[model samples]
Target: MVDFTPVPALCGGLLIGAGASLLLLGIGRIAGVCGIVGSLLDAPRSPDAGWRTAFIVGLAFSGLVGFALAPASVTNVANSPPALVGAGLLVGYGARLANGCTSGHAVCGIGRGSTRSIVATCTFMLTAGVTVFLVRHVVGR
Candidate 1:
């Protein structure tokens, strides 16, 4: 069984909130990772794109820093690497097709009192739950 501690979860939530707040205050941008990554790939149009690129780069490096500094703090799940990579790609494609990711739709969108976002988030949750059930129980993974 996987054990999850609330302390780290709360800290992660705090950091996410801080990042979103800073993005909103400092750059007048939403701290959506998908949007940030997409904007960074294009030729610079908005003057704010530079900072967005930096923020995205820093976010990427933070994962490396966490693993390096606290290797034992992380858990590794046993799975086929190819299967995981394919699943990740499919999820990314789905998120892009859906116009936003869980962070954008669930966190920032719902926070702004958007009815569409609320519906989207609920749909996302339902679909995720169904998929997990099918994969774990129905498929006997």
Candidate 2:
């Protein structure tokens, strides 16, 4: 059986929107994680890299804090932690290759009236649905 929490989902969406809007309104920058990380790596001389690093660090710490508060909230599937980390790295690379993460493309991009973002968001949704279906039905592993 599956466990779904709509409240958390909605709250997360709202936070993402607020964060992206804050970044745009205050710093005049896009809240795309891949872009921010890439820029920090490739353009280390840029002044704005500090805030970007802080943002990424905060993101990492949020999960740690969440687990500290409610350890059960975290899940461990078939793979080990190292395997999951490798998968995450691959996904991050894929997101960069695709030019944006789901939050950046789906939430911020769509809200900004971007056609490319719209398509990218739709693609993300469709791919997610297909992956879930295949994992649950076809594989049954």
Candidate 3:
């Protein structure tokens, strides 16, 4: 069973929202990880690449800090390297197809009252729920 840690979860959510809001307010960019990474990869020499690179670096740095602060909270359920790679690829594809990730659609876009983002976020949640149900119940994983 999943451990219920409301305080930590709430803190994390607040941090994410703050970060997203800061990015939007500071540079007028949505805090979408996939879009940032993709744009950086596509045009490393672009003028906006600096912020994108910093954003990616900040993400990595925050993960490291989180691990350092609470090593026990980190969990790695995917033991297989190939499985991890496949999952990453699938997620990238899905994000590209959807034109945004959860952070973009559910957080920043929804905050901006975007109708398309609302629909996309709903689809994302529904798909995630169905996938989890299939994996845990149907596949007995």
Candidate 4:
């Protein structure tokens, strides 16, 4: 069974919301991580590279901080490194196809009342639910 910690979840949600809001308010850019990383890869010397690098670096730093604060909470459920890498690649591809990641659609787009983002976010959630159900129940993983 999964351990659900409401406090940590709430805190994480708040932090994410705040970060997204700050990015939009401060730089007038959506906090879509995939787009940021893609932009960096496509144009390393672009004018916006500084903020993109900082945002990506901040994400990595935050993960390190989380692991340092609660080592037990940083556990990886995936046992195979290849599987994890494949999953990451698939997610990146999906985000590129969808034009935005969950953060950009669900948080920032929904906040701005975007119809396309709303539909995309719903589709994302539905797909995720079905995938999890199939993997855990049908596949007995």
Candidate 5:
């Protein structure tokens, strides 16, 4: 019943893991998007702001390059601008509340064997399942 394409998924996971490993090994930093972007926005004059800015811009540029390289890989998921904006706001709020996003908890923190990250990762999975259930069944969407 799994609807996912495992090869692509695995490849993406490996890339993410490699990226995280490189960040950790090279600069002793966690490759958490929320934290990186947050630090850039919250403290533009911080000593590490240059790196953070470069990281964020590199992310955006990578996406743009990917889209240009494979337009088929970029499918519109039927989301409006406002809906996307609201989702971004919610994600930012959640990141602040949890002190990190899924990448930080599931990848870096869990890799470090942090108890808090494990719990947060589990919570993220549970919440995702519940949201899907409600969306597909309860809300009839």
Candidate 6:
């Protein structure tokens, strides 16, 4: 049966926002996964690599810890490896083309009152809604 755990979800959202806020305060950088990963790859000798690498590592480590604590709650979908890879590639490409991602545009950008971010976030939400509808209805999940 499905469960509605609003407390955990709210706590998680608060933690994410707090983490992003702290990152912005400490390093003046947006805590966007795509931007962080992309910049890490783009600059081989950049000093920012240290923090960026640490950030990515921390994200992975957090997921591992969460999964360890709640194995059943962790997502273990059975999608094909190739399909996952293709989706990852498409998402990466889209993030690059969009100049930011959900984290950057929705969280940081909205906090900063950016018009572009608002537009991007709205567009992203609309597109995601349509995609989900199509997948669940037209494409049969």
Worst 10 residues of 1 by lDDT: 35-44
Worst 10 residues of 6 by lDDT: 70-79
- Using all chains and alpha carbons, the TM-scores for the candidates as numbered come to 0.83, 0.81, 0.92, 0.91, 0.91, 0.91
CA-lDDT, candidates in order: 0.79, 0.85, 0.89, 0.90, 0.89, 0.90
What is the per-residue lDDT of model 6 for residues 69-120, given as tens digits with 9 covering 90 to 100? Answer: 9887677667799978987897899998888998989988898999999999
lDDT of 2 at 80: 83
Q: Which stretches of model 4 miss by more than 4 angstroms?
A: none
| Residue-level lDDT for 43 in candidate 3 | 94
Model 1: per-residue lDDT, tens digit, 11-123?
98888888788888986877767766666665467787789778878887987898899988667878799979987887777666666677777878877777877887898
For residues 1-141, write the lDDT of model 3, one tens digit per residue. 988999989998999999998998998899988889878888999999999999999999988998999998688896489978988898898887788898988988898999989999999899989988998899885
Kindly give the number of clashing pairs for every candidate: 0, 0, 0, 0, 0, 0
Better of 2 and 3 by lDDT: 3
Give model 1's TM-score versus the native structure. Answer: 0.83
Question: Root-mean-square deviation of each candidate, in angstroms?
Answer: 2.3, 2.5, 1.5, 1.6, 1.7, 1.6
> Model 4 over residues 118-141: C-alpha lDDT tens digits?
999999999999988998899985
In candidate 6, which residue ranges exceed 4 Å CA deviation? none
Better of 3 and 6 by lDDT: 6
Show where candidate 5 strays beyond 4 Å: 1-3
**Which regions of candidate 1 deviate over 4 angstroms?**
42-48
Q: Looking at candidate 2, what is the lDDT of residue 48?
A: 87
Question: Candidate 3: lDDT over CA atoms?
Answer: 0.89
Model 2 C-alpha lDDT per residue in residues 1-141, reported as the tens digit of each score: 688899998997888788888899998988988888877888888888799998899888988999999998787798789968986897778788888977778878888899999988898789879978987899876
RMSD of 3: 1.5
lDDT of 5 at 134: 90
